[model samples]
Target: MLTAERDELMRIIRQLSYEQREVTLASGRKSDFYFDGKQTTLHPRGALLVGKAFYAALRQFPAPVQGVGGLTLGADPIATATALVSALEGQPLPAFIIRKEPKGHGTGQWLEGRKNVPPGSRVVIVEDVVTTGGSSMKAIERAREEGLEVLGVITLVDRQEGGAEFFAANDMPFVAIFTKAEVVG
Candidate 1:
C-alpha cells in the first residue's frame, strides 16, 4: 500500500512540473502537456516525498534489487534520493548513473557507482518520467553490459504514452508513482 507521501509528490508535480502547453518531448513527439519532473525532483520537500514514496513502491517488487539507477540528468536525483532513503531505512540501496556516452577520460566507462554495485548486482532503473521508455531502455542495456541484472523500472510519473507498452513489449516490469491523468486531470 502506498503512503500519503505519494499523493504529496503528485501535488508537487502538478504544481511545479505539469504544464498544459504544446511541447516536444525528448522522444521527438509533440505533447499537449509537459512534465519536466526536475522541477519537483530538485525541490527540498519534493525530494523528501519522492524518496519516501519510491522506497515504499520499491518494496513491492517481487525480485529484490540491490541497487537503483538510470540514465543521467533526469534520473540522477531520483536514484540518489531513493538510495539515501533506503540507507536511512537501514537497507542501503546503492545508486548508479548511466551516462549518455562513455566518459572521455579515465576509464571511459558508461556507468558510475560501479564500485558500490559490482557486476551481477540486481538493480532497478529509476526515472523522473516515462514517455517512450527509450532513456530507461538505454540504461538497462548499459546495466546489462556491466553484468548487472535489471529487475525492473520505477518512474516518478508515466506520461501514459507508449512507455508502459514499450516496457511491456520488451518484457520489462514497470511501475509508476503517478500517471499523467492522475496528476493533471
Candidate 2:
C-alpha cells in the first residue's frame, strides 16, 4: 500500500506538465523526450513530497546514512530539502554538494558543505534525474574518494534506458520516486 507520504509524492509528480519533443540530454544524446525534473522537484509541494519520500526511502537501508548530497545545480535543492526535513523529523541528516570540477582557487575543494566525512561514514547520493547515470556515478566516485561509504543512490526520476540496470550491475542500489513512463505517460 502506498503511504500518505508516497501518495503525496505521486500527486505532486502527476501535477507536473511538459511538452513532448526531441531534445538533447545532459549525456549528449538525442531523444524524442525530455524531463525537467526541477519543475516538480523544486516546487513547494513537490519539494516537501520529495523530501519526505527520500527520508522514508532511506529507512529501508541497513544502516543510517551520515549525510545525503549530490552533484551541483540539479541535485542541490533536493539535497537541501531532504536535509531540512530530516532535521525537522529529528533525524538530522547533513547535506553536501559536489562540484563538477575542483575550484580553481582558495581551498580548491571539489565537495562543498560540511567537512569531509570520516572514513566509512555511510552516505546516500541524490540526483534530480538519472539518464545515463554519468553524473550520479561521478558523484559516487567523488564520495568514495572522500572516504564516504556510499550506501546507494536516490533520484527523483529514472529515465529507464538502462540506468537502473547499470547501477545494479555495478552493485549500487538505485531507487527513484518515478520512472520516465510514470511521468511522461
Candidate 3:
C-alpha cells in the first residue's frame, strides 16, 4: 500500500539525494547517477515515510517478521525508523544493528540489541540502497550466525544493477521501493 506519505517521500528522495555525476560507487563501479538514501532516510519526513513503507513491505513477507535490521551506517537509521513506525502501528518490531566487525572489548558482540531479538526470531534485513548486494549479504550472514532467520530484504533504492539478481540467486526474497530510473527520470 503506497500511502500519500510514501509517494511524497519518493519525491523528496529524488529531490535531495539523486545525483548525476561520474563517481565510483561502493561496488567499485562508476555510475552516472547515484542515490544517497541516507540523505532522505535521515530526514524527518523521509524517516516517517521509510518506516511506514518498510513496515508495510514487511507485512507481505511469507513468514512473520519479528524484527528488522541490516549493516550499520546505512541500515542503522532505516532499521530505527522501521521499528519506530512499527511501534506506532502497535506491532512494535524490534530493531537490531549488525556491526561490520565484532566489538574489540566488553562482550565483543557482532550484533547489538540482541536482548530484544532473540535467536530463532524471524527478521527482515533492510538497506538504504543496493548496488551489488554485498553489504546486505554481509548483514544476512551476521544475522544467521546469531541464529536469526532472515525472512527477506527490503531496500529503499535499487540501482537496477546486479543486486536483484544476486538476491534471486541466493533464494532470498527482496524488495525495493524505488529504482534509479524512477528517481532520476
Candidate 4:
C-alpha cells in the first residue's frame, strides 16, 4: 500500500508536469519537453512531499550522513525543506550550500553552512533535476574539495538523458523520485 506521503508525492508530480510547445533547458538545448521542478518543489505540498521522499530514499544509506546539500539555485529549496523537516521529524540533518563560485568578499568560501563539519563528513548531494549530470557532478566535486565524503546523490527528477548512467559509471549511487518518461509521457 502506498503511504500517505508517497501518494501525496505522486499527486504533486502529476500536477506539476504539464504540456508545453517549446521549453528551454538548463543546458541551452531546445526541446518540446520541459520540466519545471520548481513548480512542485517550491509549493507547500510539493516541498513537504519532496522532503519526505528524499529523507526516505537516503535512509537506506550504509553510513551515517552528516548532512544534505546541493548546488545553488536549483538545489536551494530542496535542501532547505529537507533539512527543516528532517529536524522536525527528529533526524536533524543539517543542510549546506555549494556556491557555483567563491564569494568575492568576506569568507570567500565555495561551500557554506558547514563550518562545524569536520573533515570527511559524510554528505549526500541533492538536486532538483539531473539531465546530463553536469551540475550534480560539479556539486560532488565541490563537496569533495571541502573534505566531505559524498554518500550519494538524490535528485527529484532524472531526465534520463544519460545522467543515471554517468553516475553509475563513476560508481556513484544516484536516486531519483521521478523519471523523464514519467514526467514527459
Candidate 5:
C-alpha cells in the first residue's frame, strides 16, 4: 500500500534526480532521460521515506525476510535506511553490502555486515534503480554463494528497460516503488 510519504518520496526523486537529457546508464545504454537515485536516497527526508516505504514493501513478502541489502555504492544507503527503520519499527532487518569483488585485505570478504546475518537466512535484495539488472544479479549471486536465500528484489525506480523482464526470466520476484514513466511523465 502506497502512503503519502511514499508519494512524497517519488515527488522528491523527480524533483531532485530525474532529468531530461541524453545520458549513458551503467548498462551502457543511452537514454533521453535519467534518474540519479542517489541524489534523493541520500537526502534526509528522502532516506526516511524510503526506509519506511521499503520496510512496508518488504513486509508484503510471502515469506519471512531476515535481512535487506544489495550491491554497494547505490544500495548502501537504501540498505542502511531500511535496516534502521526496521529496527525502529520493532522488526530489525539487518543490512548487508555486497562488494563488486572481494576485498583485498582484512578477512577479504565479498559481503560486509555478514556477521549480522546467518547462513540460509532469507533476504530481500534492494537497488536504487534497475536497468539491465546486472548489479542486482551480482548481489543475488553473491548472496546465494554465502548461503542466503534471496526471497525477492526491490528497487526504487525501474527504468522499464528489461530489468523486470530479466528478473522474471531468471525466476526471481521483483518489485519497484516507482518507474521512469511515473517519475518523468
Candidate 6:
C-alpha cells in the first residue's frame, strides 16, 4: 500500500530523478526515460520519505527481518535511512551494506554490519532502482554467502523492464514503490 509518505516520495522522485532523453542505464540498456534514484534517495526530504516507506514495508513483512541491506552505492542510503526510520519507530532494525567487491584492506569482507546481526538472521534487500534485477540479485547472493537469510527485495522504483520477471523466475519476493509509467508517463 502506498501511504502518504510513499506518495510524497513518488512526487519527489518524479521531480528529481525522472528525466527524458536518450541515455544508457547501469544495465546497459538504452532508454528515452531514466530514473537516477540517487537524486532522490540522497536528498534530505527524499531520504526521510524513503526511510518511512521502507520501515513500513519491513513492519508489514510476513517474517521478521533482522537486517536490511543491498548492493552498495545505490542501496547504501536506502538501507541506512530505513534502519534509521526503524529505530525512530522503536523497532531499531540494523542496516548492512553489500560491497560490489571485498574491501581492499582488513577482513576484506564483501558485506558489512554483520557483526551487529547474527548469522542466519533474516534480511531484506533494498535497492534504489530495478531494471534487470541484476543488482538486487547480487545483493541477495552476497547476503546469503554472509549467512544472512534473504526475506525479500524492495526497490525505490521499477522500470517495468525485465527486473520483475527475473525476480519472479528466481522466486524472490519483490516490491517496488513506483513503476516507470507512474514516473515517466
Question: What RMSD does each model have against the real structure?
Answer: 1.3, 2.0, 1.2, 1.9, 1.2, 1.5
- Model 1 lDDT at residue 9: 76
Question: lDDT per residue, candidate 3, 29-53, as tens digits?
Answer: 8888778888998888899898888
- Compose the digit string of candidate 4's lDDT tens values, residues 49-163: 8888888777767769888999998888888888887898898888899999999999999988877456688999999888889899999999999999998999988988889
lDDT of each: 0.90, 0.83, 0.91, 0.84, 0.90, 0.88
Give TM-scores for every candidate, taking all chains together and pairing residue i with residue i. Answer: 0.95, 0.91, 0.95, 0.91, 0.96, 0.94
Query: Could you give me the TM-score of model 3 versus the true structure?
Result: 0.95
Mark the regions of model 5 whose C-alpha exceeds 4 Å error after superposition: none
True-structure lDDT of candidate 1: 0.90
Candidate 6: worst-modelled 10 consecutive residues by lDDT? 1-10
Clashing pairs in 1: none
Give per-residue CA lDDT, model 6, range 1-185, as digits (tens): 25676778888999999888899888788899878889999999999999988887776567678899899999999999999988987898899999999999998888888787778899999998899999899888888888888988998898888999999999999988778888766
Question: Worst ten-residue run, lDDT, model 4?
Answer: 12-21
Q: Ranking under lDDT, best-scoring first?
A: 3, 5, 1, 6, 4, 2
- List the pairs of residues colliding in candidate 5: none
Candidate 4: TM-score?
0.91
Residue 93 of model 4 has an lDDT of 87
* Model 5 C-alpha lDDT per residue in residues 73-118, reported as the tens digit of each score: 8999999999999999898889999999899988999998988888
- Answer with 2 or 5, whichever has the higher TM-score: 5
lDDT of 2 by residue, 98-181 (tens): 899999999898888756356677999999889989889999999899878898999988889888988998999999877878
lDDT of 6 at 138: 86
